[model samples]
Target: MPEIGAPHKVTHQDGGNDEISLTGLSGLAGESQTPLAHKTSHQDGGTDEISVGGLAGRQIFVPYNAKIADINEADTNKHTLNLETALSETRKIIALIAMTSRVSGSSVFWVYPNEGTTGIDLVATLRYGSTLIIKDATQRLQYSQGFANDDWDLYCFGYVVEI
Candidate 1:
């Protein structure tokens, strides 16, 4: 029944809820001019909050202690993730990539928009457990590399434009 594009190997190990998905063709390009996803609501520490924009259609509250980034085990890609120069000074579109459990390395992570580039356009390409979320439809921003010396505990959400 399955064999058109391949990549359906749900590994349950033994428990109950184990899922797998790879629905193909994210080769990018949904057409970009960015902007088109704005919604908003307020109140945080006092509760009463909602931010359903996911890609910043207006719900762009984004303050999970401000975009954490730590990649040890000898970081590379010239070592980045110092975010919040207003989200690394423009150009962001990740959506979500929350990996915690200290995230050990298997290598391969990219989500870039800064540090003066010339080529190599990427906005997301993480590995390890993989796919907690990856929004880039061509909003683009891939810039990350290896990890081993410090382990990992990275988080990133998106939308600087393009819903």
Candidate 2:
């Protein structure tokens, strides 16, 4: 029998009765094993509690896209898009590609981080065939357009990183 809290040797070849503890595994660089808890500090005076192995300072990119079709001039309300479905998670937008199928001569689209934000406080201004490369941390996005009596198809493509 194995001692309590000690590493156990696997004697079964079927791999069905194996017991393993993360504390028993050797860390990278052959260091002594320890519990999988790491705290990292950020430049912005924030910290993250990481629990997994080999996941520190690594970013995973999640693809995001939204299509707003048949947007008319009367549709002046702020359209809100949630970058992540989960409310507890926040994501950073790294890049964006905004395309419009039809645009009037004076048409313009504004992208912002919050509701009730006017065009003056926009994070990005997009027109027909616009691709923007930016890094902004936000959980939700607000989109609105400026024009009248025009039908447009808006397509947005971007990638986000969960913070």
Candidate 3:
């Protein structure tokens, strides 16, 4: 039987550029939100249909042809989201983030409310081994009692990449 989650395309021949592909080897030059629900819904070309909530629970009918900016960065945070530069430059906005932790045999994730300030209740995304973990970026994780920290690093609240 074939293994689950197979790669779309597996290439063995090195692309010739060592820096281009980072398969392994650590210590190497490598590496690499939300709120204000902007309700969006659409009648498929009739293939995909989804109903999303708008800011403060407002209902909006989004059509298939219309791609809405559901997450209003300006309203997401109490402070202003100076996205004019990014918006003008045309960037994908990645708002909030989520965080997660892994245990002996299971994983845990968390999500927080996005209220603008980079203080508390943020979200984050973490990657461990083969697991993609997402959790509350700023909220104190309620895990093992000893693992909790009061001074959690505040994950900057904003869209990293324009959506």
Over all chains combined, what TM-score does candidate 2 have? 0.37
TM-score of 1: 0.21
True-structure lDDT of candidate 2: 0.50
Clashes of 3: 26
Q: Candidate 3: worst 10 consecutive residues by lDDT?
A: 61-70
Model 3: residues >4 Å from true position, as ranges? Answer: 1-93, 96-99, 103-109, 116-160
Estimate, for each residue in 1-163, the C-alpha lDDT of model 1 and write its tens digit.
Answer: 6566654453342243562333453543433335543432334543556545564444243433333555564546554333434355344444443333345656545443433353221223333323332233433333455544636556554333323
RMSD of each: 27.4, 15.7, 27.4
TM-score of each: 0.21, 0.37, 0.15
In model 3, state the lDDT of residue 148: 26
Best by TM-score: 2
Better of 1 and 3 by TM-score: 1
In Å, residue 124's CA in model 1 sits off its true spot by 20
lDDT of 2 by residue, 1-163 (tens): 6457654443433353553434545656355455643432332234544455556444555544666344565666666655444222355554445555554535566655334344421223344434444334544556666655556666765544534
Question: How far does residue 136 in candidate 2 sit from its true spot (Å)?
Answer: 9.0
